[model samples]
Target: MAGNSDPLTPRAKLAVTAGKAVAAASRAAGRGSGSVIGGRVALKLDPDLLARLAQNLDVVLVSATNGKTTTTRLIAEALRAAGPVVSNALGANMPAGITSALAGGSDAKYGVIEVDEKYLAGVARDTDPKCIALLNLSRDQLDRAAETRMLAENWREGLAGSKAVIVANADDPLVVWAASSSPNVIWVAAGQMWKDDAWSCPACGGVMQRPGDDWFCGECGFRRPTPTWALSGDHVLDPHGSAWPIHLQLPGRANKANAASSAAVAAVFGVPPQVALERMYQVQAVAGRYDVVQFQGRDLRLLLAKNPAGWLETFSLIDPPPTPVILSVNARGADGTDTSWLWDVDYTRLTGHPIFVIGDRKLDLAVRLEVANQHFQVCENLDQAVQMCPPGRIEVIANYTAFQDLRRRVGN
Candidate 1:
């Protein structure tokens, strides 16, 4: 079957039509992006609209605490080589967003979706995805997402009965624990540079030993699973140890890991490794995650780092010394009101570089930087901060809302 040619009942078809009308009305009124409202109405009407929409398409689901948006984009881009691929490019990962994407691309034969970590199980079950990518899990929105371990348990239970092949990051203990019970699994050593959240075994609650890069739990014998796909620097190695060079326009080791995982997922769908990497190289940015724009006579590169683990991975991508960096933080509902995760990040790595701080929570970041003995100046606005820095390409890193705000302010 091609596209959403799935046999939908008359009521389901009517529900989809009504949902599209509501979405069009929302866009006409300039209320919002209109993505959520339509999906909301559609689901209300049919109550099983997602499953109906997902029927008869090759679906790939990407979920994690971080990099889901980018990874989804990479997978979607790679899948485009085969045919038309539908995806939520707006970084929407909830049931509403997934419904919106599927509805919008009802004619597409392939679907690549980024799913919210909390809703992955339900979405996976509904979509019956052919492959599911489980990236690293860490502490995010404690007030909302609860602890990282609980989310892993949810994934563990949800994935145990899933027939879809699981492609997981073997380096992350949390991901390992969550995907261990999966019958069909493809482990990828996509690299995990941050381990603050995975110090203990999620299975037995015993302290995990990290001797070199491998991790193991002495009490339960839980350990990092051997990877079928591995990333060695910029090279991606297959099970036979043959390697393909991955060149990405998006910088960072985390992105390389994303590329590796994407390649693995693509391979499962019959896309060649070289072909996947070639498509990934063509991707410049993912919904403004990494985009360079001219603002106030300066070239500014935007990056989003919401949690401690995110910050750790993003910080590693920054050029050392001599380059000025802008750090923006916000404690909004979307960004997790608690700014305490800032202290968990190793701000000391940025000590020798010139840092300018700006955001609703800029003072909190300034205080943290001071405690870390990193020199930084507080700026009232992003443009002013960009001006304060020496003229050239400046890296601007922000949390969720702050990054969105700056992206709008910069006119991109």
Candidate 2:
């Protein structure tokens, strides 16, 4: 949450009242998507609403190209051991959503916010968070986000002046470059699974060598910083050489990496490594991510993958060969209009799995699968796709809005 515990001015109070009214109306009309419209109206009325709301709160901002929402949830869960926390739980990472969340949880003493990468600096500036988690960066929403390097530069500039201690990923070259200059930083070697976005050094534009787990720039002396917190197997190692086992319900190496990063931030706030990991393991799902639901009399596991990097991570979690999987891709506004990134994903890894393609862009995915020499069936609807699979448990992987649609269908 954003605002302080102190009494609000008449103008700010009016804005808050109006925003709540709008939010209530939106929910009554089946449109309350958690601060989409209400937050906008509130911010329009009071331009400095976020700054006012963020006063006296120990805020931790989580930003990344992927996994910000889940990472934010993990941090919030860990922080609950301390006290009440306000967070954007609906997957909205913009200023308006943040303001609305803050306003709703005005009494909370801690705020764990999931911030969009482009707006991280602005939000961090307004909130003055005690800790900021810098997760991995990669190409996402090319139409809106442009080049990834530009974002790295923005993060670098934004974090340079912030007084908050930064918990950064040492494996990500871009993350290293962005948080390198920060006065206080805790580096975590949360294994980099995707290196496609970090071919070149962000500092000198030189080719980066990944001869081993560590990366170094060829032209410049810039290299991956030694991390005090590193992930070894399914455990997180502290500065004192103690390993804490992480047991998260969320599947994939990506979530393990997220847990390690969240543990680092929790440690900064005096939460023990074992306690943080225990709290994180209790998170069965974030919103609809990694949710198991009954759809049309069949059990289905719902997973969301928004881009090439995300898809790569999702594939790693799925059972190989013999398992039937459904992939739904929609080129909606939320999912980005361009599906060109699909080609960059290594669908070849799923060579032997039975993939049922569904959604608006199923044909495009079918073409990719065809080129990869993978076997797939194109179905018209979710029910039909589920019926096509064998009885019992099935896996469903969708992108952004399609995942939301599935969640709605299951009444989640």
Cα lDDT tens digits for candidate 1, 1-412 = 3443557789888888988899899999987678889889989999888988888689999999999999999999999999889999888789987898898886688889999999999998899888999998999876678699999999999999688999999999999999988999999999888898998889989999999989999999998888999999899998788899999999988999999999999998889999989988889988888898988888888999988889999989987777899999999899888878888988988977899999999999999999999999999998788878986789899999999899889988
What is the Cα-based lDDT of residue 319 in candidate 1?
A: 73
**Which runs in model 1 stand beyond 4 Å of their true positions?**
1-4
lDDT of 2 by residue, 115-203 (tens): 99989999998998999999989998777785998999999998896789999999999999999879999999998888999998899
In candidate 2, stretches whose alpha carbon ends up further than 4 angstroms from where it belongs are 1-5
lDDT of 2: 0.89
List all candidate RMSDs to the true structure: 1.4, 1.5
**C-alpha local distance difference test of each model:** 0.90, 0.89
